[model samples]
Target: MPVVHHRCRRTEQKAEELTNARSKNRQMGPNTLLAHGPYDPHSLHGFVNPPVIHASTVLFESTDAMRHRKSLPYTYGLRGTPTTKALEDALSELEGADETILVPSGLAAITVPLLAFLGAGDHCLVVDSVYTPTRQFCNGTLRRMGVEIAYFDPHIGAGIADLMKPNTKVVFLEAPGSNTFEMMDVAAVCAAARAGGAVTMLDNTWATPLYFRPIAHGVDLSIHALTKYPGGHSDLMMGSVSATAATAAQLRETQMQIGLNAAPDDVYLVLRGLKTMGVRLERHQASALELARWLERREDVAEVRHPALPSFFDHALYARQFSGCSGLFSFLLPGGFKQAATFLDALELIGLGYSWGGHESLAVAVDLSDRTVAKGPKDGTFIRLQVGLEDVADLKADLEAGFAALAATAGTAG
Candidate 1:
């Protein structure tokens, strides 16, 4: 395998320029930054969008250039292209980080940071409410690598200090955790990790940089699954890891070592998605909150676990930390998995699927039995919904149909 060095003067200069520009426009809101910060239309002959450059081989102009490939802006496609750089720049700005690296998927975004920081004999404190795949990776691969992994309660907050050891290298967190929607005190957890000499990382996919800036909250690395909200169309897959200056080089080196790179086309699509993410997320937030409120009034709903709702246990924390919420949240049905299946089967507008953050509404049955520390809403069947840009009235009507199915199921079962 060819080793491509990423510490090129040209690349650094471009990134520095972007960073300087961002500093000058500190008062600009997210929407304005998303529209114009990372891209320069004038540089590309006044084209609005960055050109997608598809290339694996970057030829040197002379023998001297070939010898100094490490100093050049780009030596190979795997290192990065103009398309990749554009997205990275935009995401870095959004995340409030010094740099951002792209990966093949959201899971990779999580794994890369772990691999970069953890080694044999090291310990990792992972919140139990994390994305299931992330937990699996830690238990399976990290354990096999001789790294000790511990699942701590999502609500542990400052108490995370007790769980840390001298060998602890990373404290992993997912705010308003997966499926269960339990929020963590991010600043508190980061403080604990920092005091214990452990790096703090967060999966910021749900809130994004628009609602929650993880780096600003003292996180060392901010990870995002661009597959969801950033893709916005369900047509692409990519993930990003944005890091502070102290950790950026290590992340980039580990990424290069692992040969983790997203496709150029996928990078372009995500860049396109980022442009409209702010507006799309606003719709998602409004529709989801409206739907959550409607579900709260229903007699069949056992519980609504949306952080944006005042009823949620962590609503106060969410209010203080997050600027807004996304479209994804979970609700509990009255019965077991049977009732949940029936409810899903009855939905007309909401599609039953695995991934969200697209233009369409989706619902999935969630079972948290595998969770040891943070078993969520175990009394009833959990249903996670991703509200799309559909009309709120229509979405409410769709859920009304789902509830009708749940009621019919109960009647039949009785």
Candidate 2:
């Protein structure tokens, strides 16, 4: 009896500790939360990281248990496991969402909620400067499904209300938009959507939750390409859609109906990556801003489109919306595709690639012909840069080499 009393007392003490820890967690800053927000090491045999549970079928204790499968936190591997839940919980907290659903890829995150909310005869407004894949999906699949799509200027702001019809179901936004880096008036647009009884979804990948929280600003759904900043490494591919309490159930149901699931190992990688996102973003913000500013001063560069830069057209709006900037930005050279290619080919450190947010810097020559509203510089070609964690000085030197090669080639042509 004495031993039983002692064990019970110990249990009570541990329960108290856990409660206190959770209370403290609620008040901790972002960096601290990243390190120790949702995971409980004590609950998992003191393991620092949650176990990667690879599962498809879960065994039940009896017929009664199988009958009441819905009562269990997990029923099947594809539905979810403790591994996926850990990452989901972490992302939910980060994104300020009631719940977050993981998908196989970033584009899946964009499509799931879109497909869930919009149907035949529905009208959807997508920002003109959205990610290329999103535009393609809207034009192809969504349109083919009998949905009417309108591409609005990123700078439309409250003017979006003019375009809203009674059938308008979704307003999609991507601030500091893909390639061109055009900043949107997120709050104004969201407010306009709300007034028109439309749901607002923003692709928040460029400004991760570390820099911005869209839900707090009236966004119904916040989409993230976890393959980018959340994975931290270029090794994994995944996406997540975080929804407000009002929209969570619908978003979740859509994800389930579509049979969407991220690989357990990739989910684990994102979980590990979340712990260091704050620190990694800090470096990305600092280095990218430095590079943007440096490029602005160079005689060869025509324009630099980094929202964080004071000279940028939407700097004030960006300052109001985001806490900080990410490593992706673009600059322009005084020539078209050929000159851009010459410069990129000459670079030794920055690789020419499609994806960004990895540890290594990448550069791409952007094609702006697809845009209807946000046009790229006509006098020059835009070169998008994904400034990585490398020393800013080295990146500058590498860029200088590209400029030298371009100048030499141009002189030979003359």
Candidate 3:
């Protein structure tokens, strides 16, 4: 057989196997995760949700199979179980990845893809406003490994073409940067990375695959902190990395070597979370939009960094690439940390917490002087908001109380 034919045949088989895993009844048996989740084939199980499989070990039948660890297929629990497989399969479908690997947290999601694609002496281009820990990983850990990390303005767009180096291995992007929420030109960056022979990875947690599919945008790999949206209840901590067929095999192998596999329960929880994510996101969006509109009209507010908002700096890019928006965003308060603290303390409905993506709204004071390099305002009180599934009117009332407290305490800066 010709080489082209041989390659095509192998690709077809892999695609077929992956497809079988998705349909819930195409012969791989009903995927327990998707039977009521994404892979509902019969549509007759009538269960509104997928069953949660909590298992550390999957027993195999034959001795030969046990010895080779190949009898029932997935050998050990860490390698993943039907539960993990179901979640992986479900996410793989969502992200359009040839394969997916689960990790313990959202940060793990960032580090796994980084470690998989980069090596000593290789160069990395990272967005400045990335999740702080991710920026730290590139500077601290990747630097320790002799890898060079370069920071380019997030809004550089196609001009990023100028930053490419011969040793550039990967380009890391986070749309609407974690704290400041400035949308980047995802397609432009991926195109430049492709021409420069570097893989592109995006931390797509802000929008999730439901709102934005990175694979369709030419990204080589997509990372998610399933802890946020996919694990919508915020009860489970999980991360995932998705890649096309060529890179997925390598990612899976690297994932095993690092032993960063997430627990089966986490996998199950994430799977369950995925079911209502679409609906939950709509709720989040509604509340967030109302809240952002309210903040924009606030006496102490300088700017709102929501992509869906017309006032956001990168609203144009976001409007171009994203199908819809999510609830996570930030805004600038007039005073610095003092006002942020005052407003947070005054809030009755929102919690002041380090982490977000929960049923309850959250607020935090963030400083961006060191991180903000673009045309963003120079000095402002940074407050990030994770708009939760709450009544917009109630959330607004809570914020109104917060503003009242801020006015009383800070005397209301224009």
lDDT of 3: 0.80
lDDT of each: 0.91, 0.91, 0.80
lDDT of 3 at 40: 40
Candidate 2 overall lDDT versus native: 0.91
**TM-score for each prediction?**
0.94, 0.96, 0.86
Off by over 4 Å in 1: 1-23
Order candidates by TM-score, high to low: 2, 1, 3
Q: On a 0 to 100 scale, what is the lDDT of residue 131 in model 1?
A: 94
- The list of candidate 2 runs beyond 4 A from truth reads 1-16
lDDT of 1 by residue, 111-141 (tens): 9999999999999999999999999999999
lDDT of 3 by residue, 1-414 (tens): 698687767766765665576555533322333334454423223344445555556677777778877445577777886667777778887777898888899899889888988999899999988888897888788899889988888888888889999999899998868787878888988999899999999999888887798999999889988888778886878899988987898788888899878886677777777767777888898889888898898767888888899877688888999988888888888776777788889998888887666788888888665574653566777788988988888888888888788888855444
- Please estimate how well model 1 matches the true structure, expressed as its whole-model Cα lDDT: 0.91
